[model samples]
Target: MSESSRWTMPDMAGILSNKIPQDELKPGDHIYSWRNAYLYAHHGIYIGDGMVIHFTRAAGQEIGTGTVLDRFIFSSSPSHPSGSPCPRCGDQSRTEGVISSCLECFLCGGELYLFKYGVSPGVFIAKTRGGTCTIAPSDPPEHVLHRAKFLLQNGFGVYNIFKNNCEDFAIYCKTGLLVFTNVSVGRSGQATSFLAATTAIVSSPLRFLTTGVSGLAAVGFGVYCVSRYVSDIGVRRDVMKIPVERLILCPGPLESEATTITDTSKEKGL
Candidate 1:
């Protein structure tokens, strides 16, 4: 294959593998670790000195859906198996909102993985799992670090699984983009995966065209992939780049206006 073709080809290895050693971690890097048997992933911003800034709910409140999801998300916070508070973090299991924790506490016994940004679309679609990578480009390390630290002091709004979660927090730190629509999913790929799976099952038009079960399944999978790709924050047009400081000052009204604009665009078929 030509060099250009090779570059465009799906990187199966990159898509499947994102593990990185601790020594490789740099300040301002976006990192995550799988939790709950890979059902979901917890994300954070690495801000050097073996510390990470992440957004999360208080213990026992990870998932605000008021369903069985709360059980699966129970271990999303920083806790040690020894049943003792982390010496460096100091019993943060109940702490909520943006807070800093040591890397060991953040991983919570899971393998370390780096979140990729500015990936090729082929590579993005090839990864069946979401929240692992994004097609959006990350800002400079300094900028990313600034955002993380700023949010750590300010806040990132409430913790909602489908809307504002850990993955959404990390993504916003890396990229200053935020979706305006309140009805839509945030930047978290895991949330997108959930919605896409639902869309594939219920809204896929391919059911009418396919007869065989295998063909139907294939069509559903295609729909799922397309849904994930288009819903990605990098690919969406409704996102607006807002400064972290301004977001902190007027988060409520700005989000309201953004939602209004999104609804208007949809009504006009944009």
Candidate 2:
């Protein structure tokens, strides 16, 4: 989220409406197919019907939408008139042209990423998914931890909700960079509030996007194209499905299981 980045809100919205046909795609959006499914423009293209084609880096599989973004956030260098530090990682890198948000950076640890909408710049709330333990890195004696709350993507649309309350903090010790990632919700009213917000987002989309018109139109045209870089590339592929005659799968079953003699010597008449 750089001021000069080309991939701004309005720009991405227009591209989405065009490629997927706004009406069909819908507002809240239900793109992901499943655990391993890659529905969004990043990995593949959603062509009219209930099908998508993805172009991937995997050799043979490089033909269509690639890996599933199981906790992946897309990243791209902002390509606006000027450049600034990334709001997400604060990386002071300069990008040219239209560096969209479709590409991802592993630096964020693949835990969170933007889908259709853009993540607002400011204090972010990052919640821990079920069964996932949160931890902060620390040196020997010192435990310097930075806490970022988690927000649930509920029906509220995308407003970046997460009550600001420092339930976690980091302090340095003689040992090392002592860190605290996930502090327990031990009857702390503030921590409970954040946890509730996180759940809301996971369950409700109407709520997350309820903020409406987050003011992303400021970024000009160049900033816009960058968001769809991955999608545009995904759409370029000729991943159209072939007819039944072209299928490589065999419909018939094996006549019977191949039987192997108990002793190879018996079969060979040794």
Candidate 3:
């Protein structure tokens, strides 16, 4: 086949699959996958051993009620058969049982997994650079991972998409600060801004009465929209500036490199 023909061959990789080496991903490394063309998309933190802790909604779950769960980047085969056919994949066989499980996970708004065993999302993983949102962690990766696991164990169920989404969870795990840089985007941002402004106006009517209700509402909404737009753009630009050296975590030759490096650094007295 000609080089041109080879280039035309389909890249059948899953949507979450990438060429990132596994070793560089320390626990508490922020990982994200594109939910759409843009947005920080879905985010989670690596907790070693091909597992990640993230806030996710299962199917039929309401927002703000999403659970924080530990999920493997790859799914394990169901220990036993449910015997119930998955509506999405239409398979009831034992060998393909994990497919139904993964389908349910995805349908329920859980994290997408493209396991090392080669389960595809029926789509290629969109390209992404693995990077830290905050530079130079104040705490070590082990401590950060411990914090994440602590929260997971101690009911870290409070989830606000704009203020306390997955990104917020991951960042908080890495750094003690609870923040999501992209919190100023989309409906979540708009709603939050509007709420704060509106609450201020409502709480202190006389102070804001210089502008009538109509004018106040208009001004408040306008300010929020502009602020959200500016903040979102700024945060996105900053996030992109952070260098992403490793792939999200491909679980290959470098599988234990991050831990090894951390240990070596300790031994070196760095």
Candidate 4:
């Protein structure tokens, strides 16, 4: 937590959006919103001009339009009346360029909107400070932005919570490599992890005695799964308990929605 070094989250929050001035946000920096300390629900890349680019599942047709294929949302502050909640905050705006409110995002999944506004409250923003997380060569900031823009131009594709998610997009932009973290969800995920470990342990000898290469391979795979789950579970529990005081925020040009935004907007009609 020193000025010279960057903060690292052992598991969730992956650095906890440690508050810093938004002015410090440069193109290619990662911004995220936490469902809580244990769960980072959204992530995007800052593309300057107060805009962020991130992959989302939210997409639809125009007023008279039908299904559309836009997944990457180019987001910014909404142009709502000053002091009023942003029109795009919930499901209010059907326009393709707004980030949906948390409620809407939770209900129908998220959409990628461009030009609509502000991140959800208590959302955290972060950027790589010194170097890259992996050995992948880090590009210059301009190059990073260009890469992000190029991906956005390609539009969004299928979203997979486990395989392809927001963090994968942001990290790819910054480091030119697709990466996935091992963090999972709450009780259900914990139960699955436990089951995976127990099955691996219980099936080892049986598989070794009864089957051939494929059976042994399954046991090996189980070993890998158990190790991964073991490492992740302890940290996951710790993160859920992290003190709120440890979170960081930036202090610079504040977006208008940052102050007045809430979870109430026009609901999506059937």
**Per-residue lDDT of candidate 2, residues 115-170 (tens digit):** 23222211011211111111222232111111100011111011110111111110
Cα-based TM-score, every candidate: 0.92, 0.16, 0.37, 0.39
lDDT of 3 at 90: 46
User: Which stretches of model 2 miss by more than 4 angstroms?
Assistant: 1-30, 33-42, 57-114, 122-270
Cα misplacement distance, residue 220 of candidate 4 (Å): 18
Question: Which candidate model has the greater lDDT, 1 or 3?
Answer: 1
Candidate 2 overall Cα lDDT vs. reference?
Answer: 0.23
RMSD of 3: 15.6
What C-alpha lDDT values do all the predictions have? 0.88, 0.23, 0.40, 0.39
- Over 15-92, each residue of candidate 4 has an lDDT whose tens digit, in order, gives 333443556666666555433232223556677666666655433221111223222232222223343445445333
| Highest lDDT against the true fold, candidate | 1
Candidate 1 residue lDDT tens string, 173-247: 999999876465888899999999988957966689979989988998999999999999899988988899989
Best by TM-score: 1
Clash count (model 4, backbone only): 15
